[model samples]
Target: MKTLTVPDETPVFPLRWVVATNDEAAPLVIRLMLALVLFPHGAQKLFGWFGGYGFDGTMQYFTETVNLPYLLALSIILIEFLSPFLLVAGLFTRVVGVLISLLFTGIILTAHVAIGFFMNWNGSQPGEGYEYHLLIVAMAVSLLISGGGKLSLDSKLAK
Candidate 1:
């Protein structure tokens, strides 16, 4: 019997550069804002908190009504549900930022673009628009560029 050896290569996670952050207030504020805004949304989907449908309800709606694939729907639910905690902790900020950016982008292209740019402040429009998603995307992009910032785990890890 011959023994095969695995080759040593660069590890995929904990890339210092990926998590490296500055001790500035801007990114910290942005990160907290994003987390605060998103946490309830995630809790709604995952735990039915804040009048959300919870996992099964959301999954069914996403699959049956929205026509999303199971995997995609699951991913959306999980990301929305779990990413906020990671965001709050400032762990993997860049990666979470990328995920958030992609998630909102998909949401905008699939659901919001047809509605238009402005949100339905009144009950006039049939559905909400992409403006909110755009803001979230912008925040995510900022985090991607700036990292977690002051008091962030990223900064601690980078040292």
Candidate 2:
């Protein structure tokens, strides 16, 4: 004689809907590689370690020497520093991938494209070429497609 009520099965958090699978191995590899490369580069810019110019010096180079706007330099610095941190943690994988891709695009357009696609094999070139940026873009695109892989915080968080 009593009416029955059913409970909703929907999850409260969005990340819960995106379940990680064993197929994430490739993404994991890509993420790890990106983290390894980016972290030290970022450290150089932000902290002056590894022979990098510190924040102010990097800002001057990026803004004055490179002719980038002040805000753009700051954005580049923040993205370089923060993206690697979040990427290593595997948090917001897609967003981080996009940011990294964008940064590489800017680098290619501003600095490397004119030098051509290959590395300066003889070390006589004034600047490096676009090969490394191309590799980063490829890896970033892969991460964007696959999301963070196994052993990532993103995978754990989804659970």
Candidate 3:
């Protein structure tokens, strides 16, 4: 018989805990952000909203200038318009991400990169060029790798 004392042993990981909690919110938040940003851009291309070059205008650029077939142009438009909706809803996110990433890459090469990094579309001093597209490329890449996360429609659908 003897008095025994047990020493407390606990590990403290504040940063890990923070990241874990933040991860819980990452899926829905990221999907929403991507959807909100992309949907309007897609809408502009597909439906000609906010001064977007409608189907005809886009077709001229695609078929004549870009040398793409009408079918290809239509595919691009459909992919852009539909994928963003699926992305926003967090459905089939990886597939949408892959398609969107390819679309953005084509846009960067065909339009934005030629104007140079710092030049705007109107050839103004402060350019609105490929930088934004590059950023979107990065986001698409992330979504492709990570999937929709725990809080997504993907997860719900899986269940």
Candidate 4:
């Protein structure tokens, strides 16, 4: 009788099929920067930090002034609060990117477009413009295409 040897195989996960790793600094920096930028907005909306309207105030403003449905108003708050953390953690990067993009799109179309490209430059106006939102969208789209970078939890979990 002849003895046969089996080769070792690495275990695979379903996430491995869906997600890829780059382990590059660009995506990692972008992800971190985006989180740094957006987290403050979330904190403001959720906790009234940085002079932002708290949840109740935002809900009222979105409903009465902006005329958005309550659900949408609430969703904006929750997404703002939650998405940045997930992005920072590098978990569910693609989904979070899409969601942030959508949220910013709605903001641009409904509010910022009318305000123009610059945000009350030289104190000439009362509100901000679409430029910031556009920048956010661009960053998010990049992450959507690339997935999270090397330091992300997504990469670690995939392995």
Tens-digit lDDT track for model 3 on 21-112?
Answer: 12355656667787888877778877799789987888788899989989989988898778777876677777777888898999889777
Candidate 4 — what's its lDDT? 0.85
Best by TM-score: 1
Between prediction 2 and prediction 3, the one with superior lDDT is 2
Cα RMSD of all models vs. native, in order, equals: 5.2, 5.3, 11.5, 5.9
Off by over 4 Å in 4: 1-18
lDDT (tens digit, per residue) of candidate 2 on 1-159: 333333665444444424332445788888888988988888889889899998999999988898889998888888888887777778888788888999999899988999898899999888899999999999988887777887777777665
Worst 10 residues of 2 by lDDT: 13-22
- Of 1 and 3, the candidate ranking higher by TM-score: 1
Give the CA lDDT, 0 to 100, for residue 143 in model 3: 79
Pairs in clash, predicted candidate 2 = none
What is the per-residue lDDT of model 4 for residues 1-77, given as tens digits with 9 covering 90 to 100? 33333355555664563356578878888889999999999999989999998888888899999999999889999
- Stretches off by above 4 angstroms in model 1 are 1-14
Reference-based TM-score, model 2: 0.85
- Which regions of candidate 3 fall more than 4 Å away from where they truly are? 1-23, 119-128
lDDT (CA) for every model shown? 0.90, 0.81, 0.72, 0.85
Please give the lDDT score at residue 141 for candidate 1.
97
Worst 10 residues of 1 by lDDT: 3-12
Cα lDDT tens digits, model 1, 32-109, are: 999999999988888899999999999999999999999999999999878888888898899999999999999999
The stretch of ten residues in a row with the least summed lDDT in candidate 4 is 1-10
> What's the alpha carbon RMSD for model 3?
11.5
